[model samples]
Target: MTDNFYMLTWNWLADSPLLAAATEVTTKSDGEEGTFVLAGVLLSLVIIYFASKLGGELCARINLPPVLGELVGGVLVGVSAFRLLVFPESGSLAEDSLIINLLQSTAGMPTEVASSVFASQSEVISLLSELGVIILLFEIGLESDLKELIRVGPIAAVVAVVGVVAPFVAGTLGLIYIFGTPVVPAIFAGAALTATSIGITAKVLAELGELGSEEGQIIIGAAVLDDILGIVVLAVVASLVKTGEIQISNIIYLVISAAVFLIGSILLGRLVSPLLVGLVNEMKTRGQVLLTGLVFAFVLSYIATAIHLEGILGAFAAGLILAETEKRKELEEQVVPLADFFVPIFFVCVGAQTDLSVLNPAVPSNREGLIIATFLIVVAILGKVITGFTVFGNPNLNKLAIGVGMIPRGEVGLVFAGVGSASGALSEATEAAIIVMVISTTFVAPPLLRLVFKETETATEAVDKVQE
Candidate 1:
């Protein structure tokens, strides 16, 4: 039966009209050219979506955020773990490959074949991943109100400042003293530790339906501020790494540029939003609201990238402006489905980036990196937790929850470490340790947050009874 089927397949292929054309194409390219396969792309997406949903369902069963599950699912299918989506070893995907190798060693196909396949698709996959994040942030922005952000602005700023300063100082000193890292790489590590993955925190809060609460407001507000501060820190540190000297004027210029860009964008967005709403409302087309919202987001995202800020920031700002418009509810309803489809991809990609082999005690270097990572993780947790107690407003607020919310290092930390490694600022051991710290914080924070908020709810209920 098998032999007959094989003969039939070859005979069918030989008789096909495109057979001569196919042969000519193969002759021309000699198998060197890679073509994008639609079926493969679709299969990858289906696998990722299902794996993410399964991971999310598992986390939900344990009373954790679905975001946590999506992340774990990514790890399961990512190049580091199951090697589901392997990329090239060098050339275009060299950086992405390095990241995967740091987390887990590659296996399966020959390097040449794997590289060819990844090279053809990696750029598109990366762009899609970025779009996922953009939509995620835009949804977050829609859920948030400008008034709420402003209301918590002062406390958030205070929280952000303390969060940034505490982690930087402690992380730097700990790396230098405990890990025996040099000053520059230590600075890079410290800077990496200071990053708070606000996207993860926002998703967790939103999952709990606490996104509109005072504590949530404070956390989101602080996270936005934290992101700005992180950009500044990353810029300064990256500059120092590149130049081997800190130019005070250059630092000042970068800071001012970031501040101005954020402020200017928000101001401009607010001014133009009224006209945008009017224009969209005038359109008789179906889904005009959603289309306009996306266009607005994409334009701002483009402007942000042009100015060296993360595109997600622009997306968030666009959401904020749109949130103030009359079509806010309609926009939210329309954007949810789109967000659902894309958001899990971002989390899965994040998870797939993890390298668990680093924790294997059987490997000596892994053991050493694990030790350093363990110490750094402890520091990373404590430093953020310390920020919670420093909040002066709202004595009744859940400070612990706020701190726990800020704990996850997520993508931002990985990006920082990746840059440092690329520039030769961080040693292999140090880079490995940083990735461990990032993964640990991200993994533990969700459950820890649930535990913290559970206590907060209990305390609040007790207080309510006493008042009654």
Candidate 2:
């Protein structure tokens, strides 16, 4: 049956008129290329929007966070399930993508053109996804109280330190000792455990109307600090893996630059916000406030990326500074629609990149990784959870909520896995284990965060009523 099908497919392909013509046509006209690229992008966006909305709606109906639903929806339509939404980042070529295949079959887009279009379309969608998260962080920053965030800085610093250290040490040591894994691979896996996905947690907190709460502020602060520390750790680990020696100067440079980029941008943005206000007031144009806000955020985002730090941090700083202005209320209202459009793209893309088939123990090779993943998952959760308890002098704060908020590793963890795999620094089992850890935490943390926060809120309200 397989040989007969292959023979028939070859015969059909050999008889294609367009394929013969396209084979000789090495280049397409600029207009032709543009039209094809746009079509692919439009179709991909349709899939993204529909998947995100349907997933979000279903999740909302179940009283779960809508973001969780968007993620699951992406999984359903993405490589792991339907292959409807896929990306180049996961080692998938244009041929592996169903979207590209569909376009090629329907629109007569040739293989070479399809490949180019796929690359361009994926990069555009990825950029838009990046923009979505930056806007999300900016919105989160706007909602946050700078004064409160500053007040919790010392505690957050402590939490960040512990969060990074506990996971790195425990994961590395446990893997090496218990699993008999090699030193470098174990360290890389441990590095994967150290990421705290501020974007995911912040979005959840916003949805729950707890963005400005004490626990929320601590989680945000620690998470921001965690972001910086995680980058430095990743740099150190990647260097160590590549060169067999850590570069002290590079480590110091990353630390200094990240600190300077964040602190410097916030101070400068605050100083310039007055001018921003004046500029906005002078302009009598529609969308003046929105455009100005986005430009400022994008400029800072560009600066941060150029300086080797997270762009979202710059966007967040921009929001914090801009929130101090009298036009904050207006700006906040303006940014919401943009967030509504772009933010789900980031979440959905994250989900689409995730290949959940690795989790299936039905495959004999997966069982070992599954066993190792169980260990990493436990460590990843407990590692961050312990950080919340380390916060001193905040008795009324929901410590568990703060801990749970830090639980999701999300995309940051994925970076560690991707890097480890690319660098050949991790063994097959170790890579699978790290991926499983990330996938488990990324999906698990959302519901757990809501549960912890909800329980804390219920307890607080009950006590308030009793006191009243």
Candidate 1: C-alpha RMSD after superposition: 8.8
lDDT (tens digit, per residue) of candidate 1 on 132-243? 9999899999999889888888888898999999989998998898778899999999999888998899888889888888888889888888888898899889989999
Instruction: Please give the range of 10 consecutive residues that has the lowest summed lDDT in model 1.
Output: 99-108
Q: What lDDT would candidate 2 get against the real structure? A: 0.90
Candidate No. with top TM-score = 2
Q: What is candidate 1's TM-score against the reference? A: 0.88
Each candidate's lDDT (Cα)?
0.82, 0.90
Q: What local lDDT does model 2 show for residue 331? A: 90
In candidate 1, stretches whose alpha carbon ends up further than 4 angstroms from where it belongs are 1-35, 88-114
Best by lDDT: 2
Clashing pairs in 1: 74-352, 75-351, 75-352, 103-355
